[model samples]
Target: MQNTDAKVIDVALKYGYQSVDAFSVAFKRMHGIPPAEAKKQGLKLTFYCRLHFALKIEGVDRMDYTIIEREPFTVVGIRRTTPYGGGTWAIVKSNGNNVTAEKFFGRFYDLGLCFGFGQDGSNDYMCAVEYDGETIEGFDSFTYPAAKWMKFEAKGSVTENVLGSVWQRINNEFLPQSKYKKSDLPTIEKYVSWDEAADICNVEIWIPAILK
Candidate 1:
């Protein structure tokens, strides 16, 4: 929204957004308001742009992650279908604030695992527990084939910044420079621990990956 000589779409393109809709969504997510509203209210936006978008500089903090291979496994729990990149995953707040989340976590004492499936659109989500050959009457099962994965850490009590940046950092920082490429498998989220009173939880993002 800064260049007077450029169309909105042109500005979006220049900044690397494929389309204005994606740009606006990102803008709204970052600023807590739609770009149109900010523009209408005359809100001047400023950002800290890194040089060449690189951190080749020494002493740059590294993201926390690990590479591991896992055998075939299955998760059993509640499942829901939602549009890809919709409010389901877009939530910047704790899963504690969600009704579905409340039920999913509350009912299961086992370590929580969320499985997300999609390509370009249509997300199938399952909030479940690791299956041990026992059937969960009210729940369903989602099985994952054996694969290697990149595991990312999402720390802190606030889900918005920590969890949200997991995807961004993985895509922009890790994948771009690594010898690993994403594989065709569902993205898995493991809830390591949750402190309801403190609203603190350890979340792990696992993306199926293959080495180049």
Candidate 2:
């Protein structure tokens, strides 16, 4: 058996955790007990191994997407910087007065804009809309450069959590095995729902990429 503290530290470093405290918080959230406590109590611990994406005929599923080159555009809205996996989205969404795309930009189009900039979820999340070169008071603005994007459409019974799952699949399963590399640009989530109470709606996720 490995030493508990040593094992925790090693795992933390391997996973790019800043400190043991941060690692412990995430560990407890996932495993239902602190690492040290689990070690001391001699409780069984579950380990999640890394997943590898493979291109197989059986694994192939129809993923609807289209490639398009978009021109430079500016987005204006509220921005929040939060730690990865720290319930940042929950906090932002709960405080709907500050973070809202439709309210700020007005319901002109079905597409509501969101931009995520950062790796490992430790980054700025912006709920914004395309600005027509007009300034909005008390809002942050980000100008995106022209680039080729792979846009994936999600429709029917869409929710915030469901969109997140789609993003995970795109990153882990689709992108890894595809003939494309992610570019150094922010990912976009466009909400295309006009009816708030509707069971089905359309949404699009755009990821910047270059052919490899």
Candidate 3:
């Protein structure tokens, strides 16, 4: 691990952080220590490296997905401009009273039609469902262009962050080994269930890709 202060600053800037202090706070939350302390201690850190799809059997977990071309569609729902990492869901949770807000978001997840864009952290995170092209109050509408997509599905305990874990595997493990490359488009997250009280549920992550 390169623990140089210069390297720390470089990484902070590369990740869109405004300052070392901001990056250090996020780093400490993730790695349990300040960046300076981490460097001083020379601790080993795991990195989620960029994936390049190739032919090989590596990940033990099975990743099942299918390629499908869909026509343009529009969705309407509440949207929040989050900073693209942790606490992104706080906005959704803060909408209504505790139970009401939970149910409001849960309804969308239960319908298995919720969609998200802006995974790149450069845009707002929109939580919405397919809707007519009509304007709706208190909600924003977005149109998804027609394109090819790879949809991976997983079912497991929500407490385990199943969706997030599988997404990491797909991006870091599967994409790097496959014959396809990601496209410059927003990825989609299709929730099969959003039962906060449930032990398990289903979810899907969709990535826009093209054959390399």
Candidate 4:
């Protein structure tokens, strides 16, 4: 926009935007003015330079994970759309319908049927168990194909910080540096053990993946 001679549509395409209108919307968001308004000589503009990456050891803590092939399976249970970090444990504990994890899945599990926001965000979650071939009223189901997944362990009581840290490591540190890309299968969070009386939880996060 600062360059009077530069065509807005041409510049928009160079940066991967599909159209000039889209680019102008993004421009106004960052500069507080549309492209046409940006031509004013005295108007101040916000400019950020390109980012550069460097090699450095990020943390001393280790992120331990294992890769395994899982057989295709189905789940049956209640589904809810929640925020990025919230899980369904509270619902399971309070339900008068006797909708416990043991009732559906034989164990505890959190399966993401689909993500919500764009660019690495939360998804639709199912408080489900292994499907028994019987459809219960008010319950949903999904069948996943066999695929290789990487599993990471998270221990400690259930809290935003404790659980969020595991996701942070995977997104910030592991995925950025690893030789694999996340697969299309729904992400799974399996609760290996839970003690509501003691507020203790042992969990595993499973991310389907393919070698890049």
| Candidate number achieving the greatest lDDT relative to the actual structure | 4
How much RMSD separates candidate 2 from the native structure? 18.5
In the range 41-89, model 3's lDDT, one tens digit per residue, is 2243334434435796444445555666778887666555555442335
10 residues in a row with least lDDT, candidate 4: 44-53
101-185 per-residue lDDT for model 1 (tens digits): 3355454333333345467566666556676576656666778888877777778776456667666767776677676788766
Distance (Å) between predicted and true CA of 83, model 1?
A: 4.3
Global CA lDDT of candidate 2, please? 0.64
lDDT of 3 at 167: 77
Poorest lDDT segment (10 consecutive residues) of candidate 2: 41-50
Which lDDT tens digits does candidate 4 get at residues 60-144? 5656666567788887766666555344444545773234555644554544344334355654666666675777676777787
Best by TM-score: 4
Write one digit per residue (lDDT tens) for candidate 2, span 27-56.
888667787666442244443323436663
Better of 2 and 4 by lDDT: 4
- What TM-score would each prediction reach against the true structure? 0.56, 0.57, 0.59, 0.59
Enumerate residue pairs that collide in model 1: none
Off by over 4 Å in 3: 1-58, 84-88, 97-123
Rate residue 159 of model 2 by lDDT: 47
How far does residue 36 in candidate 4 sit from its true spot (Å)? Answer: 63
TM-score comparison, 2 vs 4, better candidate: 4
